[model samples]
Target: MPQARRKTPFSGKAKKQQLQSKKQNKTLLMSTSSGTTSYDVVSVNYQPTRGRGGRDTNRYALKFYRETEEELKIKKEEALKELIPVPEKDLEVNPVDYFPADVSFPKRPPWDFNMTPAQLDAQEQRYFKNYIDSLQASEHWKKMSYFELNLETWRQLWRVLEMCDILLLIVDVRYAGMMFPPSLYSYIQAQKKDMILVLNKIDLVPSSVVAGWKQYLTTAYPALRVLYFTSCPAYNLRGVTSDKAGQSNEDFCETILEKADTSFYTHERYKSGVLSIGCVGQPNVGKSSLLNALMGRCVVSVSKTPGHTKHFQTIYLTPQVRLCDCPGLVFPSTVPRPIQILMGSYPIAQLREPYTTIRYLSERLDMPKLLRIEHPEGDDTWSPRDICDGWAKKKGYLTAKAARLDTYRAANSLLRMALDGRICLWLRPPGFAEHRDKYESCEEIKYIRWVQALTSDQEEQKSDVLTSESDDDRHSDDSDADDDSTDDSETAAIANKFAALAGDD
Candidate 1:
């Protein structure tokens, strides 16, 4: 401070040289302090843009500062635009269009009882590899929905097919044609196994539709026997009384056994006299439910999830008759992915783009009317997105982050309802609408109507009994109340007499 030194302007190059010298001196001091003559020099040149790039934390902070909430929202919208499925032109497509004439499902590779477990596995692997390769070579493979890829699941099906004398192919009545694969029928025919085609969940559709489907399917394949089954038969189709439902289920089992008895028995397993009936179907098509209904108990676990049964399980219906259930397998088909999802072939939780599925269902069915969702824009026009938004609003579904309407959840819930048959989308067989009159007067319809009348009569009688019992209870209650009042008055007079005695004393 006493002697002012000459202040010199430091040039950038000079400053750099000075810093380098200082760093070198520091390194020398460190080497001296360690008392090592030969010390390795470590050079750390932080070229952020070279080799493994560094994170620009400061740049990101600056960018975040520049971006307002509106801008962030716009960016989010732009990102989400990539996930949205492009709308397709709605066309009048036939259900059979999904199954082309040339395409066939993979059959179990020929394995006699002679093959060892290892040999059988090797042969199956070879067959499945060839099947998948061939499918991939064709154009249809790209369009095919997800099928059973696990060898273990297919192995279960093969076991059931090999062991059972009678093959029961259960299909949901809503999409019976799609569910029933011709290749499966062909395989059954080749095996000489008696196959009974069961249109399960008949309660979802009208009786006329059921009869029509039965007629159409039986006519299509003369050897194929078609029977309608419902685990929880609706009151309109069958009486609500458990006794009546149990009787109907028992009769159903009896009819199947009788059919099995009449069928030409040729399998070695058939000689046991214990009828082995194997149930097979695509996933979530009521295979498990049908077995439980037939046994009049939950013999097998039932789930809405596709492929819930992981292995083939055998349950004895009677000492003479047994039912074998195979894990639900998804047979390869050209069915649209959206349609497959709608059919409950795909798991809802694993859905990548559920908006497309919602769109497909909305196009085919009056989803707005079915769900009773009002238009979000207060207009008649309702797109799938609009439908989802409206439903979210009505359901009060919101996101936790910013409390925005949760359209994804809304769409997913709607799909679940449709899959569970709460929102029915029954597909009529070909020529069903034209010959509706014939189907209405069909025997199946008559039988269902008769059952409905019987159920009504039973319900009326039950109500009468309940009313009479309630009336008796009311009378008894009144008599008890009168007795309590009489006892209270007698006690009160006794107390008054005691009080007068005390006053005299």
Candidate 2:
């Protein structure tokens, strides 16, 4: 530091050279306005003068144009105006008339008390959980919600649609017009949003009718792109034996994998990232079973009973394809008593008179004409009792007292028929005549007979087993020769009956 302080470049020529070098390194900024330009020099000065501590000092200045004081004030005022306070409103007071006289309402009776206390509790918990779960699923869609379309539900749905990327509109081919409202479809289209229309329960109708249904849908919903799926494909277990179960399983897996791969490969959405595929349908429509079939595994639980699946579960098919499985949506308070009975949610065993509901539905839906059963000679209109008696006599549903028709049992049988879709009440295709031949022919008599035979065989087998067990118990208690002989004879007769049924097959 002392050596530096000796004034190494005090000469005027050296000082002038140093100043010239500094000037060359400095920046010259230019500003132009109103067809005129002004120049300003920004300098970085190095001062060699030593301070009290013997340190060199340096200074830098950047020069540019300055606005007038009045202009600066105006600009600041404008900014302040732009930031004006957002207005706030006071909360409204609740009206006295809005309060209920009794704040607490009585709890509804338990629908499943036939089960054990613990079982009832568990079922109730599950039902409540499912109800809550259904509500929560509405979060997935902006414009569509599970509950009945009311002011509150509509508002919530609108909020959901506001944020949704795609809409999956599920239309039940059976109840097409009633299930999907025109306003809802119009609203979806107005948004210019992507939509995938799923024609659910294709298995319920004949494959031939599907073409006409598709055509009808296209005409009805020209904007919507439709996709077809049967919830339950006739489970094809051909060539699969007990010994080859493992091989058959592998083959099934490979088949599903190949189909999935092909679908993925051909799908434009898979190639270019797009919206997901969401599955939605009415109760017991086989949405869950279809998912399991498509996935080639038991990913979703499938039950013969309706309303088993009560939540929207999302499964990832690929990086781009996510399948959203939704709960079976039931229109609140709109489901009729007969429909509930058919769904197995209402137990037939618990009813005081099971046939009452069945008879009501039968007469209302005209089941006699549908079945093509001619009334006794001159009878114009058949009563439920007459139909039940006739059906019982024909089906051999007779009482032990005599060969007379057991109307009680006949009612049960008729209920089973209606539930199984063997007898169609309120059967009509969309945009067609009420009693069209195609709709009439939807009843597969052969398939119904097959199902009936199978059901009858199962019942016979159960009865035979019970009778054999009772006979065995009686023989175990008795050592008498006659009793033993009678038991043996009874067992042989049961075996013969089962053998005859098996031989028929």
Instruction: Indicate which candidate wins on lDDT.
Output: 1
Residue ranges of candidate 2 with Cα displaced over 4 Å: 1-172, 183-192, 203-212, 231-274, 332-380, 396-409, 429-431, 434-505
Compose the digit string of candidate 2's lDDT tens values, residues 199-317. Answer: 65543443334444555556767987766654333331121112211122433333232110000011233235644565655455556655654564555656534444434455655
Best by TM-score: 1
What is the lDDT for 274 in model 2? 41
Estimate TM-scores for all models: 0.65, 0.41
What does candidate 1 score on TM? 0.65
